[model samples]
Structures are given as structure tokens and as C-alpha cells.
Target: MSGGFKDAKKDGSDPAGTSMSNGHMGIREISAGVAGGKWSAYEITEMYIDKIKSMDDRIGAFLTICEESARAQAKAVDEKIRSGKQPGKLAGVPVAVKDNICTDGIRTTCASRMLENFVPPYNAAVIEKLINEDAVIVGKTNMDEFAMGSSTENSAFRITKNPRDVTRVPGGSSGGSAAAVAAGMVPVSLGSDTGGSIRQPDAFCGIVGLKPTYGLVSRYGLIAFGSSLDQIGPMSKTVEDCALMLEAIQGRDDRDSTSYRGEYQQDYAGRLSGDIKGLKIAVLKEYFTDGLENEIASSLNESIRRLEGLETSVDEVSLPAAGDGLSAYYIISSAEASSNLARYDSIRYGYRPKEYADVDELMEKSRSEAFGTEVKRRIMLGTYALSSGYYDAYYKRAQKYRKLLRSQLAGVFEKYDLILGPTSPVLPFKIGERSGDPLQMYLADIYTIIVNLAGLPAISVPCGFSRDGLPIGLQLIGPHYGEQVLLQAAYALEQDLKLGL
Candidate 1:
């Protein structure tokens, strides 16, 4: 089995089917192989590099491929092992980062033309962690422009295809990161979730995606969208891989005021006992109601039964305010976005118009030319919400509703250890299915917005598949800073199913 390599087929292109075992190679397997001298760090890195170069064409998961830099990084890890020195837990593993996260000297476009040529002078906090752990920086994956849209189709660069079915859409904003892991281009990748960007893509692409509690992962070098809502997380093919990646990046950063400084540390991966015999899990009644596809409902019901068979105490819970979460999320996120995006007015940085009659025209031309349609729509909505006349009526009301939803979720979490539901309300649709209708596109994140609003941690893991062979995801949402419990429960289900690995 060519775990991360291909023998070069008749057309000189590697088919997506060629993989090591189970059609995917995980971070743990690669790290162990490199650590034990079974394979050099350089060899492991090169295998993925080769596979990505040969296979990424069909998937379009990456916007920038860091070939030379990645080779240099792998060589340094190889030297460390050759010198009989200690290596980091993730030594020699190849991982991709979402484009919105900055990497010093690498162009971080955020899948928007406005910053197409903007390269940060310093790395995002998460990139530093990946480097410290000796992980190879494979490249930056594509994303929805400024992480705004639900489908990657909103990307100004290109649309990322689902690895399972090329004709279908991969769930967005973080679709590129999810597709990279799903297609075997990389074992694990980093993604940001504001409103199901990470978990929804994981569900669509058949992988594991974890959105850590807000402030648990630093956001300094992550380009702001909705400042209060954006949280970076890990996307991988297995639950154990997600835990390992999460442990590497979660911590406080002096640069980010929102970052948390917890008491000591916990073994996020080592604590995985895969024992949930007495875990208290609740199924949200609101998530199972209208608009959920029949197939997804059936799959989720089966997943609940599987958990019950493990002796977990499962019950139904309701957070009525959650029904209003989508509306509130859009209002709040767009309002925050309007303020955050003011920096791109063509004065100091970002795209500038080639010709303009005056300062006003320059700003207008630059923005009109650089920003995409969806981005423009949100900016307008956000601006209107924050405007003087409508501030109290729109933004204030949304904030109040957001607080109500958060408090409701907090009450539910106090009673149950975790909340279980479908990661997405439906399966992956056609690429252009909802692009023309913003309301329908926003509904794609209906099941996920409340978690971000509440500042809690959540994960999406492959539980089953639709009749069309597309994947279905089961979501496990935990209270603020409750990732350990979420991972344990998710690990139990993943182990029982042996999915996607």
C-alpha cells in the first residue's frame, strides 16, 4: 500500500484511491514510523509532498504549495533524529494550514483578492506551535473569502471539490483544509470555525474537525473576520489525530489579549480512555426538527443508538433561543466584520486602484474592485446594522438574543456532559446549489452557529454516510474549556466505528 505516495499511473497523475492502509495515512502512524527509524523525516515529508503535487489538481484544496520551504524543514528534522536527539511529539508530520492564518514570508490571501499579495512579517500563533512540534509546513489551503461563506465556492481563487465526490461541494470557509486531509494530501490541517466552517467541512469531507473554545487558541496573526467568534482548530482524518493537533496549538499568547492562561496543562491525547459508559449526552430537539434531510436524520438516529449501546445516558434537551441563532449570528458577525474590514480602504495596505480622480474615488474603486460580491453584501449589512438609526433596532437586539442563546446553552451543559447532534443539517450539495441565495447558504450553518455564539468547544466526526456515499457527521459540543470530555466521548465513538482511517 502506498500510504502517502503513488507509483504514477498511465496519465502520470496519481488517482485518489492510492493510499497506505484504509486509503489514508494518519499523523500518529507517520510520526511513529519516522521516530523509530523505519522512515526518515525527509522521506515521510517527501512522500506527502509528491502525493500533493500529483493529486491536488482534481481537488484544488491548496492555494499555495510550499515545496522548497517544506523540504528544508524536513531536512532539519531528519538531522535531529540522525544526531540521536529528542524530537517533538509531531516530528516530521506534514500538516496544511488554512490560508487565513498568517505564515511569516508566505502570502496569506484569505481567498480574497484584497490581500492576494500581502505576506505577514510574522507567523500566526498556531503556525509557531506547528513549527515548534517539528511538523512540516506543507502549504496554505484555500478558504471562503475572509471566511465569510459556508461553501468554498465563495472563494475568489477557486472552488475546492469534495474528496469523496468531486462533483459535490465541500463545506466551507475551511473546505480546503478538510478536503486536503480527506484526500490523503496531508494527514492533518488547521482550520478556523466561526459558524461551522471547520466542523461542517469535516462532515462534508468525511473527517474529524475540532473548534476549540474561544480564546483557547490565540488569534493574533489570524486575519479578523468576526473577532469575537473566530477560533482556529484542527481538521484530520481521525479523532486521535484531532486530539494530538489540538494539544500542540492550545495555550495563551502574550500578543493576543483574549488568550487564556490556564492552570498547568492536561494530556489532551494521553487522557483518551475511550470509555464513555456513564457519560451524560443530550440530543438537541431543535436540531432534529424541520429542514433536516431524512437521510441525515436516519443516520443521526443510528449514531444515538450506537452511543446508547455503549451505556451512555442519552436524553432530549431544548434550547428554544437556538432557533434564533442563525439570525443573531449573521447580525453580530456582520456587524463585527464591518468594523474589522475598515482597515482595507487602500490607504496603508491591501489592494489599490490603478487610477482614481480623488481620495474618495480611490477608496471606492479599490474596494469595489478588490472585494467579492458576498463580502460586499456582508459589509453593507454590517454597516447598516451599526449605523446610527438602526444600531439599537438591529445590532443591539441581536446581541440580546445572542446572550439569551448562550445562557440557554450554558444551562443545558450544566445538566449534561455533552450535546450531540448532526454536524450539518444536510449532506454536501452541488457546488452552485445555494450560491445565488444567501439565505439558503446561511442555513447550511444552522446547526453550528450557536456553539460559536456560546464560546464553547465542538467537534464533527464521521458517523455514517448518506445513500449517495457522501459522509454524515455527528457533532459533540462541550462547555467552555470542556474539550477533554468532548474528545473522550468522540474517541469512544470513533474507535467503535473505525471511520476514515
Candidate 2:
């Protein structure tokens, strides 16, 4: 919990066996330094690599470290700078990608035994975009197996400990990426959000995370979870870094049918003036209900006060259907997961049973052996929902709820520019505290799942800490494709509150 970049020693030395000076630099500083010949990209990359090697044992954020490739890329960036050629916007910045995102020639394990050795033949669309921007991918971080869990405990390889509290979970699916940024192993990282995967972890880890509107960022190479809900997003130490990362990765990709065809703002970072005057925000009453911790609720109220000080209007709004989001999300996401994960049967390229007597037995043994318990549970639930004579009762009803929730949210957006709430109802829980209870684990995402269900853009920014000093996150939900205003408002609040993480 105490070994992040902020804990660097006075002598410019890091406890993690790297230079703390460079480690303290943000994404913009690193890229600017490398491009201006103030430092080589190799130096920044090496510093981060050393930090990861020394600190990751406690955090367990990384599943695979691409040391050789990262070094090569850094050296290439240095050469480009020396030749007086223009490097891309993110030149020399180090990034960690979630394992579910494909990286060419690098293993893309979803932290599951199935496809444990699956090295991707091509880069994910976001990965390609980052690489094009001269961003160095240091490694792939761990995640909940197949992006199916609310906490990192479901990972087959290892549990990612919270960087703020080592005994606590960092939050899930994208826990590794969140932990990596929170621990200062990398300046920025990528995470996929199906429900609350990205925002919850960002809240737990005390950092910045943004889940763009569905299809705003391409999902061509990201391993599918809920095809409709899944979105790859940025997690970073600051809001500006999050905006920079988003700008680099957001665009239309011809390969993905779901990619947004409309135009997007090119200068996301440049738009961060921290000016929220006249912005109208609605506080979702449903999010401030019984399960929310008192400390978090107080923190959100304080954030509202600050927003109001900035000349923004804040009002309580009701979206009654949001209470049903969790149920509908489970049904729809699990159903999609059941279909997307079917491609991993032993007969194709995933895990294969060694001693099966028949094809059916082989598949049965393969999946049963390779998949984690949560994944199996969801698959069974989805299969049952999609089964004959049951689709209308469960799957179809879930779709109806989703429509109602989206419509309600859209109505609110018509009156307000953004919606505000606590990212998680509680602080980061101790490892294994909720693992025994699946329903309790699911409830942790109650506030975040609705955003994904509505396919809206949302961000989780560090607002304050609990009495126990655990970080609390404030979530801002924007209308569809309203990332520009969303980031602007989040930046305004982030600067005004100044938690100083």
C-alpha cells in the first residue's frame, strides 16, 4: 500500500528498485520529456519495468511482462526523436493493458486456464492505436477470468491487491490495470467495463477511469464479455491523462461493426479547462439508497457542494427502473458471455481434455476443468435463461427492463447534462470477504451497472477517502456520446475537490 510513486524517497530512489524521479512523472511529462530530448524513451521504459519487477510481487497486477518488446519500442522512439522525426502524441509513455485485450505476438490470457497460452496474432484496435501513438506497452495485467467477476479474486492466476490497502481487493475484471496505475507501475493502463469493472476498481484504487459510450472506442480485438455492454477504457492517475488516453484510442474502426460512425472530438485533452459553469447535473436518488456507506454518501454530498460552487446546478432526480438494472444486466451479459465463450471449446483452440472417451465428454471435461466457478455459474444461468420455453420469461424480460432503464436515463439527460453518484456503495473490501457470497459481490456493482446497460459514457474520479483511509470514487454519467462535456465536468470537479492522491 505504501510503495507507489508518491512514496518515493527524498534521495530520488524508489523502494521498488527504480528511479523515483521519472516514476513520479505523469503521462504528458514522460511523453514530452522523451520527445524534447530531455530523456530517452528507453530510460522511462526501463524505470517502469524495474518498478514492476520489484513491486508487482505484492500487488500481482501483471500477468505477462513484455520487457523485450517494450524495450525495443522505446529504443525505436528514441531513434525517431534523434532523427528529428515527429513521434506520436503519447511518445514514450508506458501503458499496461488488460489481459483480455489482444497484443500481437504477446499472450492474451483472460486470467483463465482456457487459452492460457493463447498468443494473439494481431493487436486489438486500441492496442494498435496506442502503439501508433508511440505508447510503450509494458505488459498485460491480470483480470477476473473471462471478465466475469466483480473482484480480482476470480482470476485463475493471482489476486490483485489494492494499491491503497494491500489486504483489500483492487476491484474487478480490470483490477490488475487499476492496481498497476494505483501502484505506479505504469502511468496509464487499459481496462474493459462490462458492468462496473473499470469504474469500481478505479474508485477502490483512488485514481481516474473513464468508460466511453458504447462503440465510441473500437472493440474489434477485445475478447467479448457482454457484446452490448463491453467497452475498453482508460485508467490513469489524473483526469487529464485519462482524457489524453481516450483521445488517442477513440475513433472509428472499419473492422468493428459496432464502432461509432459519427465524428468525435479530436482534442479531448485540450478541452479540459475545468470550467463547469452553467452545467446541469442530476443526482440519481436510487444510487444514494440504503446500501451506500455513510462516508461515501457524505463525500458525494461534499462533491455536489463543490460543483455548485463552480456555478453548476445540482438536483435530485429519480430513475426508478435503475433498481432493476442489476437483474437485467446479469441476464443479458451472461447470455452474451455464454455465446461468446462458446468458441473456446476444446475442439477449436482452447483447453483440451487428455482422456475423454468421446467428443461430448471431451468438451464437457475441458470446460468443466478450465473454467472458474463464477464463470460456470453464469454460463449455467444464461443457458437456462436462453433455453427453450424460458427466453421470454428471463431474456426477453431483461431486454424490456434494459429498454425502460435507458429510456428513463434519456429523459433525465434531456433535462440535465450529466448524472452524478457514488461509483461504489462501499470502500474496497478485504480480499475474500465477499467471495463466499455471490449476491453480495454482485451488489458491489449496483451503482455502476446501469451506466453500462444504458450504453452511456461515465467516469469515476477520486473524490475522498473513508474513515479507514480507503479511497472513494465519484461517478459522472454523461449522455450517449457526451464524453466531451463529461470529461470537462469531471475535470472541473477533480480540480476543485483536489483529493491530492
Global CA lDDT computed for model 1: 0.88
RMSD of every prediction: 2.0, 2.8
* Per-residue alpha-carbon lDDT of candidate 2 for residues 158-233, written as tens digits (9 for 90 to 100): 9899988999999997999999998888889999999989999999999899999999999999999899999999
Which ranges in model 2 have alpha carbons more than 4 Å from their true place? 1-23
Q: Report clashes for each candidate as comma-separated counts.
A: 1, 0
Candidate maximizing lDDT: 2
Residue pairs that clash (backbone atoms under 3 angstroms), model 2: none
